[model samples]
Target chain A: MAWTNILTDLLKVNYPIIQAPMLGVSTPEMAAAVSNEGGLGSLPVGGLSPDATKQLIRTTKSLTNKPFAVNLFAHNIPSYSEDDLEPMRKLLLQLAAKRGYDLNAADLSNFKLYNYLDQIDILIEEKIPVVSFTFGCLDPDSIEALKRNACTLIGTATCVEEALYLQQQDIDIIAVQGIEAGGHRGTFIEDMPLPQIGLFSLLPQIKKAVRIPCVAAGGINSARTMKAAVELGADGVQIGTAFIGTEESQAIPSYKTRLNNAKDTDTALTKAFSGRWARGIRNEMMNEIEQAGIPIPPYPLQNSLTAQFRKLAQQNNDIEYTTLWAGQSAVRTTLTQSKDIIRNLIEGYEAL
Target chain B: MAWTNILTDLLKVNYPIIQAPMLGVSTPEMAAAVSNEGGLGSLPVGGLSPDATKQLIRTTKSLTNKPFAVNLFAHNIPSYSEDDLEPMRKLLLQLAAKRGYDLNAADLSNFKLYNYLDQIDILIEEKIPVVSFTFGCLDPDSIEALKRNACTLIGTATCVEEALYLQQQDIDIIAVQGIEAGGHRGTFIEDMPLPQIGLFSLLPQIKKAVRIPCVAAGGINSARTMKAAVELGADGVQIGTAFIGTEESQAIPSYKTRLNNAKDTDTALTKAFSGRWARGIRNEMMNEIEQAGIPIPPYPLQNSLTAQFRKLAQQNNDIEYTTLWAGQSAVRTTLTQSKDIIRNLIEGYEAL
Candidate 1:
C-alpha cells in the first residue's frame, strides 16, 4: 500500500520528518523555513501568552502559508503553597551562591509564568491544521473543540499505558516519546522513573498496544533512524535536537556553539534548569545543583525562579550555566540552514 | 562486499551476532546453542575459577565445536586497608539486622573471586579462539601472547577517547559500550561521565574514530535494531539481556519470569547491587539500599561483600533481595530453549 496519510504524503516533500515543537527555542522563521522545505514545522506555544501566540502564528503564516503544528502543555497544574516557595527560593539562592553568584529572595519574588490557556484558543481560532499536547492529555472538552476546528489532535505519551489512555480519549495521533527525548518528559499521569525506556523497546510495545497513528520521538537525528522508525511501525518521526542548529532557530549563537561541539555522549537529564527534569548538556550549574542536596519546588515556580539565571547565562555566552536541551545524538547535529538540513534528510531517507 | 570474517564465516552467519558472555547467567549450553545456530557464543570467565572455566569450555565444545569467545575483567584488584573492612562489615551488620537477619563482623570475611591470571593460562592452554576484556585492556604483553596463541582480542570502550586508546593497543576488535549496556560499565582507563549515548549515536561515531573492527553493544535486542546496527557500520553485534530466558542459561526461574514480564520502562540502573552500576529489575533491596545511604566500597570488594546476601536471596527464591541483571529488551525475551533462541535470532537476521 502506498503511504496515504496527510503526514506521509507531506513527508514526500523533504523527508518524512517533523521539526518538534521545542518551546523557548523554536522560532516563527524556523517553522516557516522547515515548512518551506516541505517538512512539517512546529511552533510550541506552551510558554507564550494567547495574544503572543496568535501574533506569532500570523507572522509564521505570512512568511510561508504552509501547514505547521502548534504545541501546548496539557499537564495538570500542580499546586504549591506560599510556604513551599520560601524554602525553594532559599534553596535556589544557596545554589547560585555556590556558583559564585550573589542573589537574594528579591530576585525570585516577582517571577511570572501563567499557563497558556489563550494559546489553545488561538490555535482553534486560527484553524491550525495540527495541534499536539505534551506531558498529558487535555480535557476532553478542549480536545473535542480542537477536533471540531478541523485540527488533527496529537497526544504525547511516554509509555504504552499512557498511549492506550490517550487512545481511549479518542485523539487522532500519538507521539510515542522514548526516554531519550530532550527537554521535559511528557509523563502526565505517572511520575516517570529515572533513565526511563530506550527508544527501540518503547516503539514496538506502544505500537502493539495502541491502534492510533504513531510518531516516534527521542534521539532520532539521522535519516537511517527516521527510516527505521517507519519500518518499526511509525507513520512519521518528530525530531527536536536535529533542528536546534538550523539557521532559522531563535537559539543563541552560544547555544549553537555548544551543540556543535557536543559529543554523542554529552547529553543527560538534569532538574537544574527547571524544577521538572529535562535533558541538556551537562554544565557547571547542574553539577552544583546535584551536589546541593536541596529539594526544588513545583514546576512553573522553579521554572520562573531559574529563568533569570538561564537568561543571564545565555546572554553572557557562559555555556556552563545555560540549559542546552539536546538528545544523545547532539554531536551529529550540524550547524546549517533549515532548508539544507531538510534537503539532506530527504536525501538520506531516499538513499535508504 | 558480503559480510565475511572469522566470526561471520565460521558460523556461516550472514552477520556477526554474538550473545555477550554473561558469567553468572551465560552457560556452556547457552554458548553452544548460539554456536550451533550460526552465531558466536561466548562464556564470560570473570566469575569462574580456572578449573571451572576449563569445564565450562569443555561442556561447550561437546555441545558445539564451533567458534566461541571467553570474556574477562581486566581491572586492577580493588584494595582496602584492614581498617576499611571493619567499618564496611559493621555497616552491613546493621543493614542485615534491619532485614531481620543477625550478622556479626565474623560473617563478613571469606570471599574469593576467580583470578584472571589463572583463567588466562587455562584459555591459552585450551587454545581458545577469542578473548574479550572489560574495565580495561589486557596488557600489551598479554595481547601479544594471545595473538601468538591465535586468539582474537576484543577490548571494551565506554568513550571515543577510550576507543582511541584501545586502537593504539593493537586489539583486533573493539566493542563500543554506551551507558545503556547492562552490568558494570567497561570504563577501564578513567571514570568518565556516563555518556548515555544510545547505539544509534555511539555506533557511527566509534566507526569514524577507530580503524579497527567495531561491535555495537547496549540496548540492541530487536531484528530491526540488528539490521540498523549493520547499516550503521558495525561489523558485529553483542547482546546479553535478550538471551536471559533461554533454557540453557543459569538465571533463576523467578528472574526469568520477571524478565519475560518486564516492560520497556521496567529496567533501571542503581549501584545498590555491587558498588559498580548495573541495570536490572528494581526490587526491595534496591529501594532499601538507596534509602539506607550507606557508602559502598569500590567494586570487587563491594561486589564481594554482597555475595553472601545475593546467594541467600537467590536460594530462598526471594527476587526482591537479589540482583537481576537485564537490559531494556528484557520485555521482549522469551522462555524458550537456547537453541531455539539462536534459531529465531538467525531467522530474524535472515528475514531482515
Candidate 2:
C-alpha cells in the first residue's frame, strides 16, 4: 500500500497520520506541531464555548499554515435531575475526604451544555477546513451547513452499524474507533446495547460495507500497528495515546510519566468519571466511584462535576486521583517530540 | 513472515493453523480432518476420563497418522456441595419449564472431576505426541513429566503476564487467546484483575515479551484476520468457531445454522451457562440464570448440571434454549468441509 492514498491526498498531508482529537490534552501547539510535520493535526474544541473554539482555531492557524482539523461534541442530552446526581456527588466527596484531598461540592446551577449550533456557526465564520464529529452524529442541517462550505466532515464510529449510518448521512470520512481506543466511546446510540469490536475486525468489515475512507483509531500508537491498519484496509491511522506521551502534548508531566509507566493491565473501561463508559488507567477516585455503585449522572454533566477534582489532582501531580485516559496499547507509548512521533510512524511503515 | 516459523517447525505442520480443541464438539473426525489438511488439529479430552482420553487418541490416530494436539483443563477444584448448586439448578428448571421444554433433573452424585494426573499417565503410556492445557497452568512436575515423555507442551494465556508465566514454566509454545476469542478464557490467575487486550494489540506485545513461539487464538477465522495475525507478529494461528460450522464439526444442525446467522452483537460473555465466563449466543436459560443472581458451583460441575438442558435444546433445534459458543466473527462462518476452512485460510493469506 502506498502512502499517497485518498486520506493523504484529501488531507494534503505527506503521511497518513491524523493526530487524535483528544479534548483538553490535545492543544493548539500539539496540533500545529503535527500539521507542520505533514500529518493531519487535530484540535478538540468539543468542551469549549464557541468563542473559545474560534480562539483555538486562530491559535492553531497562527502556529502553522498547514491543514488541521477541529472536532466538536454532538452527543444527545441525557435526562437527569438534582436527585439523580445527589448520590454520586456524596460518594465522590466521601472518597476525596478519605484520600485527604480538598474537594468542593458541585454547583449544577450553571450546568448548561455547549451550544453546538453556535459551534457550527463559529466554524463556518472561522472558515475551518476540516471539522469532525464525536459522541454522536451531527444533525442533518449541521452537516449541510458544514458541506455548504468546503469542509471535510468526519464522523466517529465504534462499529460497522455506525459507519453505515455515517455513510447514509454522506460523511466524507469515517473515523473507526475500535474498542481498544482510549477516552470515551463514540457510540451514537448511547442506550443501545452493542458489542465492543477491535479495529482489525472492524476495519475490514467497514471497508467492505462502506465506500468512504476509514481512519482506524484505537491502540494504533506505533509504526507496526500503523502498518497493520493500512494493510488491514484502513485508509489512514488516527493516533491518541502515542501523542499524549510526546513533549509537545499539553498533558501534565506526571500524566505523561504515568502513561509511560503504565503496563498493559493498568487500564479498563468505567463510566464513573463521565457517565459514558470510557477506557482509562484505574485510579483511586474512579475505583472508589465504581465500588460505590451509585447512580451516575449523564455525560457532560458528569464530566463537569469532576472537572474541579481532576484539576486539583493535576495540580498536585496525583495520577491516582484523576482519570488517566490511555488505550489498551498504553505500554507502547514513548516520550518524545510530536514531529518525531510522526516521522517514526512513516519511516517504520515504509521500512516494512 | 514465512509459514516456516518456530511454530510450524516444532509442530511439523505445513500451514500455521491449529484447530482449537473444543470439547463436546471436536470429534476424532474433525481432528483428523484438520491434521490431514497439513495443519495441527486438536482434540479436547478435557472433560473425559483417562480411559476415554486414550480411546479418543487411538481413534484420531487411526483416522490420520499426522501430528495432532490433545488438550485438557487444569482448573483448581472449587469447594461446592449439592446445596450450593440448588439455586442455579432450580432456576434453570424453572426457565426450561417456562420455555415449554422437557428437561431432566441433574444427577450430581456422579460428579467426580477428571483425574488429570491419571489422564497425564494415559497420555504418556499411549505416547501422545502433543498435549495442551487451558483454564489454569500445570505444576512444575507435570511440565517435567510431559517433557520427559518427549511430548510437546503448549500452554494457554490471555495476557502478557500469563505468557511470561508460561515461559518461566518451560512451556514449548504459548497459545495467546485474545479477548475476542470464543470459549472460556484461558486465564491462569483467576483471582487477579487483568485487562482484556484484543489480539491485534496482544499478539505483537507478547511476541516482544517472550522468545517462545506464540499462537494467535481469538476471532481469527478469516484470511484477512489470519494475515493480520501474521503481520502483527504471531508465529501461528489457532481457530475454533470457524471450524464449528463445518460438516465434520460435531456441532448440531441448529448450532451450525445459528453460528452462520450470528451478527457482530449476537454473542457475549456469560457465567450463567457454565458458572465460568464464556462467550456464546445468549439464550433463554442463560438469560434467566444471569438474572437470578444466584451463586453457582464452579466449572466442570456447573458444566455438568446444564448438559441435559443443552442436549434437549439441541434435539429440538431450538437455538434460544442452547448455548451457541462462537467467536465475535461467527458471522463469517461458512458451512464447508474442515479441510476447506484450512485451505481458505492458507489461500487467503497467500493471495494477500
Overall local distance difference test of candidate 2? 0.82
Best by DockQ: 2
What DockQ does every candidate get? Answer: 0.45, 0.57
TM-score, candidate number 1:
0.92
Candidate 2 docking class: medium
Cα shift from native, residue A175, model 2 (Å): 1.4
Docking level for model 1: acceptable
lDDT of 2 by residue, B133-232 (tens): 9887778898898899888889998888889998999999999887778888887676657457877778887888999998989878777777777778
lDDT value for model 1:
0.75
| Index of the highest-TM-score prediction | 2
Alpha-carbon RMSD of each model: 2.9, 1.7
